[model samples]
Target: MTQLPSAAPTIATEPGQTEPAFRLVAVAIEARILSGDIQPGDTLPSETNLAETLGVNRSTVREAIRALEQNGFVRRETGRKKLFAAVPQSRDISRRLKTAMVLDHVTFEELWEAMFALEPAAARSAAQRRTDDDLAALDANLAQMRLALHDSDVLTDLDIAFHHLVALATGNRAIQAARLPISELFYPPFLAVISRLNAAERLLFAHEKIVEAIRDQDSRQAQDWMEKHIQDFQRGYELANLDMGTPAALPRAGHDKQ
Candidate 1:
């Protein structure tokens, strides 16, 4: 009977564990961060300490830390040797999203739809919550815009900035974060419309109306003007002969940021 206990059936080979050790280390740290075991601004253990605690080589720990830094999970202060934990900034995430949207060939209509929802909400909230400083910034933007109307490059940038200011005026992080990436995505085809149409005067008039509403704390008027402004943008696009059916694109290479 003992001799009849033949060798167990050979098992099929499992998939190979081919991932590098540093990735596992980085993931472990990310888990710690998400679990709140390692809070932002907390100093990370030294390389030697991590190597020993993690049972990995010092080189592996270093590589893991480097990966975390690149992903905005960790950072070192200038002239300081210690590494600090960090959460990624909204702007960094928005930049990455902008790149991804361009790569994925997202369409203009998708961006416009997103903005149509967010922009009016931002205007409505800004009217209710904006501070004196917020009004000052919007006023400054409007003044610059008045001078830049004929300059497409400056005007487009101001237009984008103007909307950003409106979102900022809302004093709502949720609104700001939701709108940031879409705003950046919203500008390329927008510039195409800007270049092809005599839209600046109309654009400035709408901005002035929206600003006046915000100044007067009239949420309804603010939302109404902003919605009309966005609608005017669509109309300008139609008049420009640009095809809305086309996928979104990166700004033409020489164009400045808008």
Candidate 2:
């Protein structure tokens, strides 16, 4: 097992210069996780040990761990006493950020712009690198989406899964990691738009075309088709009477409870 760089000391400086003790610790721990020094499911050092090692107060260590847990870097096992480091799923990051966006009222236009920038690049990569397994996964998700036309919950899950499959097909872990949260944030509002437009068939048709392009390893076609497909959803949202200037709302607790 490789060791990560030691955590840096937390220092007080002028405002905007650096984060306080807790944030610094959190960043150091996150770096270890990203670098694979702290593998998923590994136990972190006890709070007292970490505090002593980092020359910080135990309260700072506690705050850092709380932040990490909130971000899905660490989770408490059910009925278990210890906290453990974990690999974060894209859903985890998206959920937190999307929640913040909802509270801050981030506009649909902002999200659409971000997607337009990211998805086509993902499509191009997937076309070049997708394997048979990746194609099969996409096919499976498409099938689920087809069956889920009337089932909003299923449709929503498959929608996210479809993009996740694309990211996986790209064979770039960094892209996959970066893409997940954005894709996750994109889907619920998209599902809302789809439901409103009665446009399930059209959406499925576009998905099929995109999948075929990836299956055929046509990078340019995949990129172009994906961009169009994503843009089409934005159009659907507008056509469905959604205010593009209004931020997409977060799902309330007990909403879409799946």
Candidate 3:
């Protein structure tokens, strides 16, 4: 029964302005959430209550709530009528961006350039900040990687997981957020390189070097190893005769991890 701020929104309209009243209502609610006047998990007022408070029609309130729900600012349990205030998570936001990237058909060269800037920085940060738990997880990943060297499909999935773990080890949410969307797009090209060049051993070697540097807290060595590893990928792609300028693709069904 937490009440919204008592003041009605002051929505200004210019002559013949086309902005919908529902959007203004949605923005008002989002502003309150962002400003911490309301918190995630707080129960939102009923639509009627909201409409009364905002001096809007009930239908406008419903539309505004729909917008908030779509943006991840509100939610209700399955089979429940009560909406709760919420914040958008990075994963949810990143998933949308990932979908857009796929639909836009971004190039492998574009993906490569982004990873070039991000992965080495992630490795370096992981080396500095990684905990014993991070090392153990990485050790487990490497073990699986060694066993999967000849299995290109499994190895590619492991390769994706390995980089994800490195990003997690960085203890930087921003890095993790930015990396998640781009990570899945790597699967197709990675699989091609490993399968075509039989480059699993080289991949394993680079991973080992990077992990060793991370375990020893040698940030520079970790970054150098990662840079070389990523560079080797481009070489493998060229050797495999794949076009880097070609639009990247989602991993084919049965190729992605469950």
Candidate 4:
């Protein structure tokens, strides 16, 4: 008579607890990647190979690959059967954090407070370290802003980009990641308020001052102007009678690009 197969090995956990096979497989593959055994651009082993090497079913390995792909740990080229390794970008992670913040019901007050601490710090850093390229980018933004000041939608996009360029000038990865999402939500409502109150000129003037301070390597001046600029946002919002208690959101429809 044929003998029954041996039972699978077990790990320590609470009674009646069993990790899903796919999850175990995913963890195994993730460990390989993190250990640098699988560098980005290295193609993953075929499902058949993984199943055989890991002593799991092909279906389990397939599911694990799917999970890894979803988490940005694995990427497949178009029209290709092989999956390549990939390091998840800070931007990809920031988008998820932004969604989580919105779901957590974060408000304009919370975002503004965070900006109050972060933007001034970023401006000071940018002032000390900004390059010719950084100044050029800011100048370009201001040029666009000059024409878009009366158009809230165009102004909104440029405003968001202006602050981002400032953050990039600092060359700090941590600060960049910290502000990316908050900045996404920060400007839209405030720009709408600015437009309603016709304070675009004031906003543009502040931006010009801050950029000049950065160009001059004047950290104190940059910090002061950034602080004033952020304060102006709050002031304009109040003047427009918009509620600060409102959730931070994307600004409404902007001018037609045509």
Candidate 5:
């Protein structure tokens, strides 16, 4: 076990530093985790130990731990007080960005523009990089999608998962990360269109074409199919009489239910 430095610099509450003691403590712990001093799944020191070591109150240590947990740097097991160090997952960070985009009144046009640039490129990369396992996952998603053609809610979820699988197949973390936040915002709106139009079969068809191109390692074909699939989204928006320029919002519960 790599022990924390015994003579760790105590968090200083310098008069003019102005930052809260808990924030300073949180930053210090975060830096240690990022620097690999504390690895994921390693048990973090107790609040008492952390407070004593950092020369802060246990209450401050508690507050810092709460912040760390919320940000995905630390986790506590169910019914347990022991905290574990953890690296933030992409989805964890993406949720915050997703919220900000919604609050900023991000439009469908903006999300569509971003997806237009990312998804096709992701498809191209996936075609070149995908493994047998990636093909299996995509196949499973397609199978489910086919069965759900007339069910908008299920179709909406499958559509998002299908695209996510394609991004994962790319094995490009940058592309995956870039698309993660935009996807929830970009795809859910399609639920409204899916509910309103006879578009589910069209969506399933495009997904099939995209997957077939990916399986054949036809990068250009995959990219082209994905591009058309995305364009169909905008067309669906227009056909449903929804304004693409309107600020995107999360789908209401049961919004996809006919």
Candidate 6:
């Protein structure tokens, strides 16, 4: 057999040899979005146009778009149609943070302590600042929780929504944003405990009490009640035979990298 020429060895570049062109483009586009040059619901320039405008390869532009999409800077319309600008949703950011916490094996005590620090404050503020719409939202979530007591999926969603509404009722966007991830992780265990203990009635009563305190604008009562309610969940977790020391479970696939 004839001898073949040896293939060239691939050279491994060091860090910062050259920044990825797509990353640079992503940063530039993200700046535009943050500066309000591209508002939510506005369509991004077409891929071809973006490539030309950014003086990069079309593939690079596509990569940049993918990064933005993953980070919640933009999203596709229904049916995977045209991409549009989007405000970075608190929920999306929270999901990513929760995934990280789970993957890193965050302790239940740490999680609970964080919740204790925030939830009571949120309750107090919500009591003082809640609007009529906030009240309506809380009522709707409570009703949904009542209707879905036996349905784990529905109950879990309502529990999360209820907490989010409370955060919004505080009328502090920063607090709402900060609470989003912690709240998402916080409710699943509640649902799990409720499911095992058949404690829907108790859960509903607690929720009603919280709502009433908020409606009455009783900040101290709201704070105290919410703290007790949350601590009650920790107690239930133990009663349900769950390992409180074990870290929360990660979503099946893996952590979502933004």
Per-residue alpha-carbon lDDT of candidate 4 for residues 60-139, written as tens digits (9 for 90 to 100): 77898898887888888897678787777788787777777776778998999899989999999999999999999999
RMSD of every candidate to native, in Å, equals: 9.2, 5.1, 3.1, 6.5, 3.5, 9.3
TM-score quality measure for candidate 1? 0.84
Superior candidate under lDDT, 1 versus 6: 1
**TM-score-superior candidate, 3 or 4:** 3
**lDDT score for residue 175 of model 6:** 83
Per TM-score, what order, best first? 3, 5, 4, 1, 6, 2
lDDT of 3: 0.85
For the record, the alpha-carbon RMSD of candidate 3 to the native fold, in angstroms, is 3.1
Root-mean-square deviation of Cα positions for candidate 1 versus the true structure, in angstroms: 9.2
lDDT of each: 0.81, 0.78, 0.85, 0.81, 0.87, 0.77
Q: CA lDDT of 88 in candidate 6?
A: 81
Instruction: Quote each prediction's TM-score.
Output: 0.84, 0.70, 0.90, 0.87, 0.90, 0.77
Model 3 Cα lDDT, one tens digit per residue, 42-121: 99999999888777789988998999998999998796789999998887787677767877989888888888889999
Candidate 1: residue 193 Cα off by (Å): 2.3
- Write one digit per residue (lDDT tens) for candidate 6, span 1-258: 111111101112225647677777777777778777778888877777776655667898799889999888878878775878887877777788888887788877677778888998999999999999999999988888888878877776777778778988999887877777766666776576666787777777888999999999999989998998889888888887777687776545554544
Scored by lDDT, model 4 comes in at 0.81
Candidate number of the best lDDT: 5
* Residues 1-258 of candidate 1: C-alpha lDDT, one tens digit per residue: 011101112111214746677777777777777777778998887877777666667898799889998888988989667888888777887777777787788888888888999999999999999999999999999999999888988888899889989999999999899888788778755865775687789889999999999999999999999999998877788888777667776555325232
Candidate 2, residues 49-85, lDDT tens digits: the string is 7777777788988999898887778877796557788
The segments of candidate 1 whose C-alpha lies over 4 angstroms from its true place after superposition are 1-20, 252-258
**C-alpha lDDT (0 to 100) for residue 6 of candidate 4:** 24
CA deviation > 4 Å runs, candidate 2: 1-91, 150-153, 253-258
